[model samples]
Target: MEFKDYYEVLGVSRTATADEIKKAYRRLAHKYHPDVSKERDAEERFKAVSEAYEVLHDAEKRRAYDQFGHDYRAGDEFRPPPGWQWQPHTGAHARSHRGPNPAEGFSQTDFSEFFSSLFGEGGFAGFGERAQQHARGRHSHARHGEDVTRPLEITLEEAFAGGNRALSVDNGSERRTLNVRIPAGIAPGQKIRLAGQGTPGSNGATAGDLYLEVAYRPHPLYQVDGRDLTLELPLAPWEAALGAKVEVPTLGGRVTLAVPAGAQSGQKLRLRGRGLPGKPAGDQFVRLKIVNPPADTPAARELFQKMADTLPFDPRAGLG
Candidate 1:
């Protein structure tokens, strides 16, 4: 696919900041989620917006994309042109991707790594200390510890079944592994608190609890609603019209289903106690849709012709 304009996808201007981009994505994603959208093209529109946001949300990719325009590509196949990181035409020229490129004038001291990484740590540690030396003070009494925030993505299946999740996070200095238990019926924006898992505090105070906000990735076979699992099942024309016993798949497994005689396409069937596991298991709904059989054989065409002649009802008669 040709590259989509991230700004247009989010319905914002090119000058929009990171925070503005995030706000736009949140609003659009929630509106166009496949489970809730009623527009015919909602799902396709959702995926497009998501792809655009994914690129625009990354600082590196966004920079490269803004420089290269539609030439940018994502995924593991990302390959930047030679000298792509440096350009005299860009404001970023003041500093190399490797901090300010310095000569021997540095007094034998060198600083590498990104500025954001440094500031996240002790890069600013001397700010309060140096001022304190002039004021006859040693340190500032503050919540003087790094606050840890990491995003945790969960699949819809895992989110449905409340369980323990283990995640690894690097909080500037240390790599901490956290195992958190999730509660059932948790919403997408719900946060899972972790007691005393943050950075070390001053004056021997305790650490802060790590907060995990849950979000879901798209599922290949299922869609999630609040405490429910929705799926689209393809049924043969015979199955939809002539009432047959078919196997319906659920999170638990497949079970035999009875298709009521004269069932129409797009009919929804509810399977009780087969949805996402909650206090009381929610119902699983299957939307049956009919598909035309491939006309690979003469016999198949002949059989279909016979049925077409026999059925006198017009399924779309009422639609003006």
Candidate 2:
């Protein structure tokens, strides 16, 4: 298999500090996240960057890779050093091919054969702080896998009413599709945790968790403010002056809204408890906008003149 130079992959110098490596990884991860990026090779690039960070972010893993990997370059044919032998991080490696609990280990899918050969499957099992213990050859109790978090974008309707989502995520080495449940009334920036779905632990340690942060897509007609929903309510001149019941849209369904007499543009009407779901559900605010008929025809012009004459009101009094 071809060797992978993780530091080069992250665009960092081999001598870069851990903090620098972390900054580089975060910058690349944000730029290449498949869901948000429009770049042609976003998925592939994202996977490579994630794999690089997985190895380099850990002190022990970085040490081992750097110490043993210096002689190689990216894409160079790689073979283990002479006298090298696979040492089991967990006794389970002796029991069977199962080696270690799959959930506790880092994902090896989509990894270069080079990485797989070096770390093997159990390499990332003790990925958390306990991984440092493994480097010292100390026998530690069960360790939890490191948690993973990613952004998830949803529509307004989906945010209003929780729904089952089918999503694909980078499960360490490869992209894996999953059926995720979105909680109702979920707001942007709120995270949903999927237990035991992250990096696996060594030996019999518990697997880490995965977190999905909620983000809402831009809607054509509505803007969200926390749990509250805001929309422009267009009204005819007569409806604003004489009052009328008009149908407005909500996630649940259409609601008939009563337009009070003398309603004006920019006036806000509140529909209580009609927004996103929560302990005390949010309200929906409708800003009224009165639209006048265009005087394109003779009759329309005549009617407008008649109204101008009949209801004499100075709109610019305040401005004056």
- Which candidate number would show the highest lDDT if scored against the true structure? 2
lDDT of 1 at 244: 91
lDDT of 1 by residue, 178-230 (tens): 66655545667766545446676564433454566778778888877776787
For residues 156-246, write the lDDT of model 2, one tens digit per residue: 8898887788888787686877677666787788776565567876765555767788899999988889889899999999999999999
Per model, how many backbone clashes are there? 0, 6
- Overall local distance difference test of candidate 2: 0.74
In terms of TM-score, the best-performing candidate is 2
Per-model TM-score on C-alpha atoms? 0.52, 0.55
Candidate 1 has what TM-score? 0.52
Worst 10 residues of 2 by lDDT: 95-104
